[model samples]
Target: MPIRVKLDDMLHERRLTLSELSARVDITLANLSVLKTGKAKAIRFSTLEAICRELDCKPGDILDYSAED
Candidate 1:
């Protein structure tokens, strides 16, 4: 996928664990894990907003795009 989930990097930068973020965002650990691992197929806008709210970051901080060869 050209779009990459940079959730792990954002968590690291914020000194937060997946479990911590899950609790703060009121999301299941499994779902957050999927996103963190870049295995998720899609994300709800509400979910994105929750993550951004807890992480104090913009959407671009968690997602990136790159051209695939």
Candidate 2:
């Protein structure tokens, strides 16, 4: 995947647990775990918005893109 999920890093930086973020973002732990582990194929804009709102961050704080070698 060209896009990398930086969710774990952001969570760590913010000192938030997965459960806390899930609750605040109104998302399931399973779904958030998948996203956290970079296993999600896609994410809805609404969900992204909720996460950003809860985390007080931009999308760039949770996602990154890099070129393939």
Report lDDT per candidate: 0.95, 0.95
Query: Compared with the true structure, what per-residue lDDT tens digits does model 2 show for residues 1-69?
Result: 989999999999899999999989889999999999999999999999999998899999999999988
Each candidate's number of clashing pairs is 0, 0
**lDDT (Cα, 0-100) at 10 in candidate 1:** 91
Tell me the TM-score of model 2: 0.96
TM of each candidate vs. truth: 0.97, 0.96
Candidate 1 C-alpha RMSD relative to the actual structure: 0.5
RMSD of each: 0.5, 0.6
Per residue, candidate 1 scores C-alpha lDDT tens digits across 2-65 of 9999999998899999999999999999999999888999999999999999999999999999
Candidate 1 worst ten-residue window by lDDT: 34-43
